[model samples]
Target: RPVCHTKPQPGNRESVGCLYSCAQCSLGGVLIAMDTAPWALDEKPEHEEVCEFRPYTCPCPGATCKWHGSLEAVMPHLMHAHKSITTLQGEDIVFLATDINLPGAVDWVMMQSCFSHHFMLVLEKQEKYEGHQQFFAVVLLIGTRKQAENFAYRLELNGNRRRLTWEATPRSIHDGVAAAILNSDCLVFDTSIAHLFADNGNLGINVTISMC
Candidate 1:
């Protein structure tokens, strides 16, 4: 006996053809036949603001120059307009000595002393993080021990006023003594008075005196 078989046909318009034959057809070839569709922008998609385009401001005092909104623009202006200052790293201490060439400006001397003390305080704060062994102390000596003592007293007063506390270290005292001796403007001066003490096992401070 012979058997008869009939090919399956789509009963409805929505019916898809057999999967086995359709699987053999290339999807890329079909896509090429249907041309690339145009993108519609009738209701344009919104984009988030880029953080890079935000305005940048500089902290340099009395600077009016404004260009591209970024720190890159302000840095060059700062370097060119203002003098370059050194930043000490890794437990560095700096002492500054000022000489009184102009007489009777006691207020100015007091102000300078206050400034020097503040600088030392900042160094001491950094020392806490870097380790006490890596700390640097600077003392600025003006004319005589009396003068230096006066400044020291002022520093103590300021500390009391601000309620600031600092750890007392031998290195700090040594730097203070050295600065007092080296900071002089007079042509006739004694170099023997200034003293420097290094608390660390190693001595590595480079001291330079500028007499003008």
Candidate 2:
């Protein structure tokens, strides 16, 4: 089926490409994107079935975040919904990583903007390798990794006279959690050891993001 060229859907904007932009879309919903060049019906089918109607969502900061879909979707939601969030213009931030009490899987999320870039950081909880609890923290650059070519940040858990930290380049939002975990680019810790750093459910961290 041909992509929709008639009009942008309700709650959507007319973008340059065939991509439909809608606010209600999770992770900013982008309609099926057709090739920029004319696609011929006689073109050979690819090696696999392509589901044009399939929906996709990008991860947002925190579990309660309803924003998802394409970048377009995020803009409006950010503008209208998060009016109180001031866009900071600095290189360093201190984030309080909390939620030590709730178990069986959870996530704490926060959004930070610096150096003209937006980032979504998620500290996720999971059970891996035979039900052993693990906490993973990663930062995703809103745009492609290329957009943040020289961007870097460090994640740290500082408390109880001890500190655990990891530093790396922030991945693109397109990079899912599983891939980061598999690549070992995230900050991971055992839930059992969480007590060492967590002070009454909150863990403090110093985040320093730089653009070189």
Candidate 3:
């Protein structure tokens, strides 16, 4: 028999069922956890709206760019402190990233502002084996993680017969361009396609961004 220094209170019936018995103290003599009501196991609260898992709506102002993110990251993301691409926000605006005639591997980063928010876009020239060349293009969001999911980017390569196009949910610039390219979210093509789209030394594309 073990000597007991403490015991469960009468009101705490939940602790009375403990297995150990103490000979010296009646209160501590028998103590064990009582079984919880079966219904307690079935009580599940809805968590879709819980803060940790909930999507954060971005506080960025303006119309064209719709952004969302986690509440914890809302401020830093809107501050636009990171550096990787130039940010631009506007409507029906066209800007050049690089000169098409420039040879070798060249990467160009630009930010476009349209409908009031900034988006990151990139143009990379890849020199292939045997002197062949390829160009890659992509659009990215500068807002939050949740914002990245709601928006879309469309790149149009205008040609005489047909137009080449690539569209995807833009990645957050926070992910870095290398990561986005590795995921193959950007448009890629060779010099032949470039030749068709290239006008003079400048290659131009019509970018259409939207939220869905």
* Per-candidate RMSD, Å: 27.7, 10.7, 16.0
What TM-score goes with each of the models?
0.20, 0.64, 0.56
The superposed Cα distance between candidate 1 and the true structure at residue 186, in angstroms, equals: 39
Task: Give the Å error, residue 112, model 1.
Answer: 20
- Cα lDDT tens digits, model 3, 74-140, are 4456556334444555634454654776877786656677655677677777654457677778776
| C-alpha-based local distance difference test score of model 2 | 0.63
- What does candidate 2's lDDT look like per residue over 107-176, in tens digits? 7666778887787777777775667888788877766556656799898877667788899888776554
- TM-score, candidate 3, is 0.56
lDDT of 3 at 165: 88
**CA shift of 103, model 2, Å:** 1.5
Query: Which ten-residue region of model 2 has the weakest summed lDDT?
Result: 45-54
Order of all candidates by TM-score, from best down to worst? 2, 3, 1
Query: Candidate 2, after superposition: displacement of residue 205 in Å?
Result: 2.2
In TM-score terms, which candidate is top? 2
User: With candidate 2 superimposed using the best TM-score fit, by how many Å does residue 164's alpha carbon deviate from the native?
Assistant: 1.6
lDDT ranking, high to low? 2, 3, 1
